[model samples]
Target: MSSMTKIADIEAEIARTQKNKATMAHLCALKARLAQLKRDLIASETKKGGPKGDGFDVQKTGDARIGFIGFPSVGKSTLLNKMTDTFSEVAAYEFTTLTCVPGIVAYRGAKLQMLDLPGIIEGAKDGKGRGRQVIAVARTCSLILIVLDVAKPLQHKLIIERELDGFGIRLNQEPPNIVLKKKDRGGMNIASTCPLTQLDADTIKTILSEYRINNCDIMFKGDYNADQLIDVIEGNRVYIPAVYVLNKIDQISIEELDIVARIPHNCPISAHHDWNLDGLLECIWDHLNFVRLYTKPRGQVPDYNEPVILKKTPQPTVESFCSRIHRQMMKKFKYAWVWGSSVKHQPQRVGKDHLLDDEDVLQIVKKV
Candidate 1:
């Protein structure tokens, strides 16, 4: 039978199986099997051509790329047009914005690329209505702005989250503190720093056995569950930061707005009335965690106009800063002078390997 057919069978079984101590093992095994089948299906599809698509391939620019994702007519186009120079068509109807519309949001001396993507349907993750292609674009983004209308059902938020989840995109979450080291003959050694309440020793063992991980060292630093463990083992998950842009607050009452405001990591604004966008921009900036390096000359003052923006991941250092400025600057590197929060004293000298802080001033001194 085909992978999809097998997957459907396993899913049906899982749905029928009740959750209890008596049937936990069977449920876990079935879930693991379903996961493997999905992985196989993705692998097969990737070998054919991958999930990428035409017109979805936009040139990434600015300090970071942010994708706007939501269902039909969710004020994504309106927000994009208000936030950036790029003019995306805005209409009252659904699915008006059919393609990826690119724009640039210049904020606090930092330029951020904003993409108003096409409206995603419920089954978009299953290759419906350019959903796979849209999510593929989101996978490449540093942050996702989940735009939603306050007038619509709040369940739409869960639906979008589910769609992104199926694509291995873990939003607003960090990678689980779990490690799996393969071994030839040492057998399975398990270790944990925290008390795992949700997952038991047997469940973990059953999961590992299901994946044919006969000999490996498993380490857990957090109290993560089986699904998270599966994600870590699968090793294809993308943990991207996301914020819920709750748009159309102008259409709602003050009491209703209070309810939307209570949602965690969300910003409620009215794109039509241009309300509370500043707060949204600030939230986006904080979520991005961009490192800004001001260029300083030997004698002249720092040029505050253009700052070298670097991503916080992989530990941003002076070497990364130089690479962003010029490719060959690192080879002729002597040392760097730093000013701001990264230094102990005023203008402390640092080397190529020195890590940088956000909004720090840097002066590169090369060898003769």
Candidate 2:
């Protein structure tokens, strides 16, 4: 039988099966089998589809990238036209955008590349109708803007999230504070600084064994669950920040608009009428978590125009800044002088190891 047929059979059986305390292990095994069958089905479909010409993949540019994803007829193309200079075809029909239409959004001295991607259907993650290609493009983006029609029910957001989730895109989530290190001889060593309420020892071993992992060290710095253990085993998951942009607010009532605005990371706006788009852009900027730094000469004023923007990290020291300018500067660098939130005193002489903060002024003096 075909892979789809087999998958359907397994799913049907799983649905028919009942749950009980004694049948938990049986259910787990069946679930694992179902997961394997689904993976096999997806693999077959992807291989049959071969290289697709959905034609949306484009070269990434600008300081950061924002990928637009949603079902068709949700004003994604129109929103792209309004927000950026790109002229994506907008029509009163489905699939007007057949390829990737890229545009630049220059805001606050930071240039953000916004891509208008083709609308995805329900099964896009399963290599259906360029879904894989579109999501692959999204995997590279700094942020995913899930555009939704306010006229429609809000549940569509969950559907879109499920598709992204199946493709290993964990939106608005951090990498789990769990680490799994492989070893040769040790059976399994589990360590935790905090109590783990979401998982137990037996469940952890079951998950590890399902992945054919025999010996490893599992460390949990924070709370985690069984799915997280699977995620750690999968190791191909991408955790990205996502924003839910509610479009077509002009069609809704003012009272309805207030309710939409209350949603987390949600911006209610009209893409057609350009209402509250500035607020949407501001939301995008904040979610990016950008760090902008200015550079100064030894005795001259700092250049405020061309600031070096970097992602925020735990230790954003001078080495991180120097590597951006030139890698060789690290060896020839003597010390750096900082004058901003990262420093205690004004114009403090610091080394390459000195951590930097946003808007910090830096001047590097090289060795003679």
Candidate 3:
């Protein structure tokens, strides 16, 4: 029998055996067999790719991909190393990380992929010192983290800012979160005294009004905390998410930690000391807004526990996501069985337009 037929038989048997105490154990065994069959069917279909399950599920890509950019020696490599298990060379000297290194940051049960691009300096977009390559990397990333060395002179910051503007990469809707690294260096604490959270509206406007952002359609992967900055960079329409890491905190005092906390949408961590790293990961997961769900054949009661993560900015529809599972599934899709927050009653069939909320189990039925 086809998978659908087997599911229907199981459901019918479950109803008939619901009141028979002597057969309850057998009924449960049948249910387990039905669940396994459904799983096997889904796996086979998914393997077909594109609608047919030939490896076309978009959810397989994991959470959003984010890119990191900043001036050399701003602790970008160190932060990346701490957040992800991958070891990119972390040196005290400038320009240590020459290429982009991608790593996964696990947060609150979700995994967010972060990319550490080569350090960018003033005039990078104009092909000065690998600026072109950095810009190329930025173009493909869903979100960009601009690392700033607060210990450096104001002139250095301006040079980096001017180069970004010169490259026409400043998305004016949301400004990048400026991560101040090495706060303990030379006993300098610029951000501590002049907190980013304390910046007035005029100051923020003046800071971002110059750049002529060229790419408007790019989508960045980050947590919701970065909404403000992403909106500024992408013209208020695009949602770019990011998490701010105040690295080298071990060298600083509790007073410094308090100051870092005060900064808007910031997470403090000491890569060397491994302090508050879990908190940072939690923040990253919250930012991504990911949800988990499971799929099975129609007419079979849905399983709630075995779910796969589906990364989405906002929740998507069952039909739309079914297409992501397999292109052929989309073509043959007749209806869906849904279970979640949006469903008002017991498991039931839904039309193609039925919207799906987070953690909503789905069993898509298609006509052969």
Candidate 4:
């Protein structure tokens, strides 16, 4: 049978299975099998030239990339037009924006690339409505802005989360604090630093066994469950921060808007009326966690007009800063003089390993 067919059968069986201690092992194995099948289906489709169309292959530019994802006619085009001043075809009907539209916005001295992706429908992760293609592009983004209509936000939000989850995209989450290392002779050695309330010995073994992992060392640094274990084992998941942009707030009442705003990591706005867009932009900036650094010459003043942008991850250090400016600069590397919150003195001389803070001034001192 085809992979999709097998997946469907397993899913049906899983849904029918009872949830209890006795059935936990079976359920874990079933879920792992389902995940593997889906991965295989996507891999096979990729080998056969997966979804392709015009405007799908957008060239990535700017300090960071943000993709606008939601169902059709949710004010995505209007948001893009207003925020980035880029023209995206807007209309009253659904699926009006059928292709990926790219726009650039300069925020806090950092240029962010915004993409108005095609409307994603339910069953998107299952490759329905060419969603596989749309989400594939989304996976490349540093942040995903899930634009939703203020009306019926919760239902659509859950569906979109599920779709992204199925595609191995973990939204607003960090990678599970779990590690798996293969060993030749030793059998499955499982260890946990904290009390794992959701996962037991049997469940862990069942999940590992499903992947034919006979010998391995598993360590859980934090309390996690079976699904997290599976995600770690799969090793294909991408953890991305997402903001739910509740657009068309002008149509909703004040009380209704208050409830919508209560949703965690959400920003309510009316794209057409240009209401509360500043708040949305600020929310996006915070989620992005971009650090801006200025370069200082030996004698000249620091240039603030064009600042270097770095991600908060991997720890932005002077070494990375040098590499960002020029790959060859590291060869003659010595140290950097800093003037910002990262240092105590006005311009403390620090080594390349020194971590940099936002808006910090850096002046590299190379070897003689």
Candidate 5:
């Protein structure tokens, strides 16, 4: 039978069992099984490039992708809708979002794309209720945003952390920023004792600096031991750089906000109230090391006055940088003229083998 028809039948059975405890238990179990089947169907459809399924291929488009992850009903969808132009369904129910929704958030004339993935549940990695599928989506993203309900119990928060671990999605590297939702709700003050909140900024900076210097050009080939893997990917390289955004600040008190602010790298905001969005945007850019660079006309003299951001990458060769501008630029079979600290002459021409450094300006003269 069709999924809709099956759901209808299950609903009818559930309604009929309202007075019978034994029948209700059986129907509820069946309903849960049916829901799992529905989720599997959705996952299969998405993998095959169908409309009903979430478009996973959207990430391959070279957009700076961010993934949203957390347990059910943590306001991830609400934050996604507020940050991007997407109209994702926002409800208090768990697992309301089954498919990933990709949306674009424009900031300061640049567009950053983010993905709102399905909610993760306990034991998600081992084929538990859309857990495996969600982890697959998270693997492809450049950044992961881990949303947490601050009002929820500590045990609940730890459940999410364990789920991430179960899926082998590393949070410490490209580690997801903890977005503490419902900060306004009066609850047990978890922020003060939060392990993440207790992290010192200076210590974080020191660790990041050491990480950059040591692993600047290191590349892993095949599967290594877990100890080696941990040593290699535990820092910023494997993990997308992240900044904490304490969402739902309008619901919290000043004292609470102050405690949250004291956290090493927290940015408070109210996604529902549309507060501090710009600050969040700025933080995202800063964390991502994203720089805006405008293109200039071929014949027109290059403007040295306007600043163009040259993003730092493990490999910043001419070939890689040129490909970013346009694949055709690389295919056109021409050399690039480098102008900056590397060359003494004005607009010094360099071959395709040239390596570009941060803030180095270039004028590519292609062979049409």
Candidate 6:
């Protein structure tokens, strides 16, 4: 059978199989097998020269990137045009925006690059409708704006999410706290800090065996399922925040809008009519989790016109801040005086490793 056929058969079996202690090992092995098959298929496609055409090579710009992903003509282009004031050629027909269109949105003193990617279709992860190319760009984004038509929001949302999930994009999720280290002589030692509720030793061993991992030390800090463990083993998954942009809200009633708004991490807006666009921008800002830092010169006041934007993840430090300003700034740096919630005292003296909070004023004191 073909790889796709095998994958389909495995999925069918996995779905039909009942959940119980007796079948957990079997289910885990099947999932691992399915993952390996997909990996092989991707590798083969890569060898055959994957999608690289159609102006998909968008230059990374601005502080961070937010990608608009959905089915064709779902107001992605319109939303991009409205938010960034960049023309993406919106139309009523499908597939109007073919290439990756990049636009910059200046919000709250930070510039965010917004990408209007080509619409993705079903089986996108399998390279349908230039889906791989679109998803490839989406993976680079710090946040994914899953634009959906408010009429059929849930239906399209599920399909688009499936596509992204298949491509190893875990939206609004943290990486599984499972570590697998390969050692020559360990002979497959498995340990867990918490109780293994979703996984057992048998299931874990089955999954590991499918990967041909003979000797390794595996540590599970949380009760993760088989798929999460597989993802951990794959080590290529990206945890990105996402917001479901339910566009064309003008067509829906207030009751419908109220129901749609109840969905977690969603924003209802009318891209064509420019309604609730502010709410969408606010949602984007919240999901981006950006840290703004102001630079205070030696004698002058802190420059608030333009603040340094940093990702809230990895928790920005003084050393990183110095590096952001200039590579050589750290060389002449002695210490910094920070004024923010991160410091106990007002404008406390701190070293390079001190972690900075949002809206912090930093004044670097270089060695004389």
Best by lDDT: 4
Ranking by lDDT: 4, 6, 1, 2, 5, 3
Cα misplacement distance, residue 239 of candidate 3 (Å): 5.7
- TM match of model 5 to true structure: 0.59
Error of 1 at 344 (Å): 3.2
For model 5, how does the per-residue alpha-carbon lDDT over 123-182 read when each residue is reduced to its tens digit?
675457877678767767766666655444245546765665544455545333332222
For residues 175-286, write the lDDT of model 6, one tens digit per residue.
9999899887768899999998888787888899899898999999998999999999888889999999999988989998898777789988898999989999898999
Ranking under TM-score, best-scoring first?
4, 6, 1, 2, 5, 3
RMSD (Cα, Å) for all candidates, in order, is 2.0, 2.4, 26.4, 1.1, 16.4, 1.4
Q: Quote the lDDT for 202 in model 2.
A: 72
Question: Candidate 5: which stretches are off by over 4 Å?
Answer: 1-59, 108-110, 152-157, 172-238, 261-265, 301-311, 326-335, 338-360
Off by over 4 Å in 6: none
Indicate the TM-score of model 6.
0.96
lDDT of 2 by residue, 1-368 (tens): 87667766876877887866455445555555555666666567567977767456577888999999999989999988998888999999999988888999988777899999999988887667878888878989999999998976377787889889877799999888788899998898999999988666776777777767779999999888666666766667799998999998889898988877776889788899999899999999889988888889877999988888788855578999999888788889899889998888997999888888889999999999
Error of 5 at 14 (Å): 43
Highest TM-score: give the candidate number. 4
Q: What is the TM-score of each candidate against the true structure?
A: 0.93, 0.91, 0.57, 0.98, 0.59, 0.96
Off by over 4 Å in 4: none
For candidate 5, the per-residue lDDT at 201 reads: 32
TM-score of 4: 0.98
Model 1 ranges with Cα > 4 A deviation: 50-53, 313-315
Alpha-carbon lDDT, every model: 0.88, 0.83, 0.57, 0.92, 0.59, 0.91
Question: What local lDDT does model 6 show for residue 130?
Answer: 90
Please give, for residues 126-223, the per-residue lDDT of candidate 3 as tens digits: 34677655655565555556554433324554575555543334432344444323222243222322324423333333223222222222222222
Ranked by lDDT, the better of candidates 1 and 4 is 4
Clashes of each: 0, 1, 29, 0, 5, 0
